[model samples]
Target: MPKSYLITGGAGFIGLTFTKMMLKETDAQITVLDNLTYASRPLEIEALKKNGRFRFIKGDIYEKEDIEKVFYQK
Candidate 1:
């Protein structure tokens, strides 16, 4: 079975690059959790949105409910 990874700050430069690399290197699914508040680009995230294994959540760390939803529901 393929593994799953949660990437915080995944919309930033380094994070986006790493996310791309991870997708290319593995068959595992990737969940990008970003608030989309600062230092993030919607276009970049959009590019990966079409991939079945890629998911993006526009939420902040301060939001416990949002964070919990992903972790617990998964």
Candidate 2:
């Protein structure tokens, strides 16, 4: 199976850039978790949803429930 990657703060510039590079360079399932903070790019994140291997989660990293969604999501 392909590797799965969980990218925190992925809507930020640096994180988003790295995420794109990973997507281009490797066949991996990428999940992005970000709270849509001021530095986040919601529109760009929305575009990432077009790729089948990509998923975006909007929630705070400080929240336990939000983090749980990563492992328990159906």
Best by TM-score: 2
Each model's TM-score, in the order given? 0.90, 0.96
lDDT of 1 by residue, 1-74 (tens): 99999999899998999999999999999999998867898899999998999988877777998798668765
lDDT of 1: 0.89
- Candidate 2's displacement at residue 38, Å, is 0.6
Residue lDDT tens for model 2, 1-74: 99999999999999999999989899999999999999999989988899999988888889999999987895
* List of clashing residue pairs for candidate 1: none
Model 2: residues >4 Å from true position, as ranges? Answer: none
Q: Measured by TM-score, how close is model 1 to the native structure?
A: 0.90
Error of 1 at 1 (Å): 0.8
